[model samples]
Target: MERSWTQPVGVGVVTALVGFTSSFAVVLAGLQAVGADTAQAASGLAVLCVLQGAGTIWLSQRHRTPLTLAWSTPGAALLVAAAGLQIGWSAAVGAFVVTGALLAITGLWPWLGRTVARIPAPLAQAMLAGVLLTLCLQPITALTVSPLLVAPVIVVWLGLQRLAPRWSTPAAFLLALALIVGDAVLSGQGVTLLAPVVSLTVPTVTWTAVVGIAIPLYVVTMASQNVPGVAVMSAAGYAVPWRESLLLTGLGTMAGAGAGAHAVNLAAISAALPASAEAHPDPRRRWIASTTAGVTYLLLAPLAATLTALVAGAPPGVIESVAGLALLGTLAACLAAATADPGERLPAVAAFLVAASGVSALGIGAAFWALLAGLAVRTVLRPRDPRAAEKPRSGRHARV
Candidate 1:
């Protein structure tokens, strides 16, 4: 009996550890990129942690499935890419709210979910790749700018990637944390710990933000996180409660939006950690693993302010290096998916280039334009249907 409980509990702990440590830097950077000051970013991180934990616990308990929820990592990456849009913090919060509303709508209306699904895979993947491009290149840039501070972290990451692939990013992030602490001590600016506080902002919706932020955020979160989450659960032989999951995540996203959190959705990659055989051989009990993970996230919420403060003090490029390393695998996967189909390559490439260019026109960001450009190129390059030119047969004597 002890073994049964311990095994799943261990897996749950690891799930939360890996999930949080591996990508928290990226989350922080993304929040900061989108006009959030350090305090606001901390609040965002804290609220996200709380919501993720709460949602995971509620879903797993209600459904008796290892259903885990996570903050929208790709949506955060989208925010990072849209940094140049100059949408103020309040507008960004408004966008988050709009994204949440859309998610709720998708859950309530099946056709909306179908429409989001119909966004061609290659185009969505290409757009994600383009957004990730600049962030993924940060490690290289950091190396050039501060090799002494960055190289050791990269070495540790590479070494662990070979030895224990799953822990590589976390290991690098830990090393970066050490560096940040050491620097703080050496500079005579002792690290200060503060209670995590949620700083609320009254969101101001704008047309530019809605076009530039909300729509793309919704698309990326749905495509990269929510849809894949369902597939992951399906692969694990569990039918996810899709509508309920969406409603919960949508509510969670909106609840935290005013506190700087971007969006929350079903976990994609990390969902497997709790749902898989690794969590429990008897799949019926795997919900415990998710419950443990949710509790862990709640415990970690209080540290968000401290972590954000430490990261805020770290030398330029150090923390970014960690975030960049964290995203490299995601970047690689997106690229592979974007270029997988021969027929879609040209259009995907077009979308990829436009998004990576960081160009904005008419106060709209590149991600939205990337989709449009890809569709336009695809339409132009598509081969004509032979049936269109053939005369229709109308009677019993016709071909039909």
Candidate 2:
């Protein structure tokens, strides 16, 4: 938190670490889902990272908030859906545009923003609980195939997290990397040599992609990812202009179109770390960390070759397993706050389970549907609490 010697650099560093480590797979899958070639997918990631980074900086500083801007996780899931529908890149871009527009619309209308903001804390807690469960599972899943590699790291990380809160994640990550490289050296395993991140290109939208892939991508990203991303930030205590942040991401994606970024929306769970961490306690300083992170991203993201190499060499299992373990603290903290109230915990948990189940009737993800379920439960159980029934007279979701 201080200026010199051991400042808030950790926040930015951690942000970038989490972004590249966890987000790489998501971006690759999303781009591939939309029919992008390896080159195109890499190009898109380079561009997306820069724009997303820049958005993080701008949003954090503008509001003096600590929020980290990130690509949509659910948006990636949307791409998985896009794959099922056999959509094209042109449509994928269009979906991003649509999502950007929807975010803009939500921001411009106070009612939508407020209504979304008003989701009961308990339900939010429940939703976050489910999110944490899924996240915690990633590392465990990784161990099934590579117990020799992942198990020891998990055990060490858990111990470190318990003993040293501030240093746990970074330390564990460093140790994991050491283990990864060490194993290669000792056993003569095929240790991959990684290049650093460098390069940039913008996005180019096509009508066909927009009409097909883009529309669905946008709907799912905004409704499923952005809404909750913003919700996560708000729940953590940073009051932000949702529309402005949305617009920033939209503009970033637009700028990145030529560079090849896809489905750039707010990051929900990952962003929560910097937005609420002790390193970013003074809300204004968070802006510095986030902005610094964004600027760092914009500058470094162009070199996909380097980033890919650096990340890939770590052995996918180690990177993801450490990632899952690192996030445990954040997940725990969120649930603690979300379930502070005993009365509302059940409905909240139910709503969260619905979201976590990944059951989608339409082309949308469960985030939106889960919120809807929670609202319905609240409406039914607490009839007299008119806030559940009355729409915000002014913002985005005020139609009724």
Candidate 3:
């Protein structure tokens, strides 16, 4: 049966939009948090989009599978929460470079990948959940500043999430957009367009950025984004080569960081969109949707500056609120994943609390400390008797 182009093209466009509107604000805010000027921030967005799109296209073609590439959303949140106002942007860029290099190593070396896999998943997820805790407060905080503007956006987001789950994020983004632009137009102060300009920055490596940003960014990108992204494709029955895909994204991340961008990685939520039956009935043909989505990303590249300008022009409260709303679903999912095991609850909770504390020492962010603290507590609290492991099996046999 010959496949029609309609589904592939339509799904591709939708997938592109989902990738863009969902986390673009987080990217911008992350860049700004690290001390990016408007030009640098816009350039980072442009470079990130291009690299993600290019990487997706290349990987999908090379592997003959539907592969979706994306920037690390959780990593962006890490930046927002941990971009030590003192470390400055150059050091952040250096951290980004280090992260990319680490990602590449994970792909190239089987031992490294296995070692990363050994990191207790519960602790990793708990750390991510804690990192996101503060940003999740934005919507509520925004209400105190401008309820009239924020209330409607939140209502629409919540309403659509139940009514049309897939469209909820885009709808929320649109509502926020309307409010931001509408206010500008009505007040006789029209929104102005700013052309994105690329400005190269030589990254300055520091112990602070290496410990505080690079390590955590690499961890979250791997655990929170790449791991689930692979699962999404595997669930859809696409035999993806995880190592090669990681290598491509890691290289792309390196290129992107050269232009002030952060990590590029595998798509998690959006991956299934292009790989699903909706994209194409025949799995082999689904690559068309991913490639088309890549083209759409390239097309949208020029608008990165405008998007940054829009975000910059909006009130801080509104921007934070929108970002918060965007991440609510992710936070819930992370929390659930972190606590999935009954036995790991204590360690996970400890990680969560420490991460949520937002403490930094000698420039290292709280997320790292949280993981360390959780592991230490888990070790101390664990049963030292070797026979403890046999008790569970014995109980099961007795029941049988």
Candidate achieving the largest TM-score: 1
**Which tens-of-lDDT digit does each residue in 223-340 have in candidate 3?**
9899899899889998778788888888888877868879999999999999999999888789989988888888878898888887888855777787888899899998997787
Provide TM-scores for the models.
0.96, 0.65, 0.95
Q: Is candidate 1 or candidate 3 better by lDDT?
A: 1
* Residue ranges of candidate 2 with Cα displaced over 4 Å: 1-41, 56-93, 175-243, 257-291, 309-316, 362-364, 384-400
lDDT of 1 at 4: 83
Model 1, 22-125: lDDT tens digits are 88888888888889999999999999999999999999999899999999888888889999999899999999999999998899999999998888888999
TM accuracy, model 3: 0.95
For candidate 3, the per-residue lDDT at 308 reads 82
- Measured over all alpha carbons after superposition, the RMSD of each candidate to the real structure, in angstroms, is 4.6, 6.6, 2.9
273-343 in candidate 2: lDDT tens per residue?
67665555465565666666677676656566544444455565776676567556656765675556554
Arranged by lDDT, best first: 1, 3, 2
1 versus 2: better TM-score goes to: 1
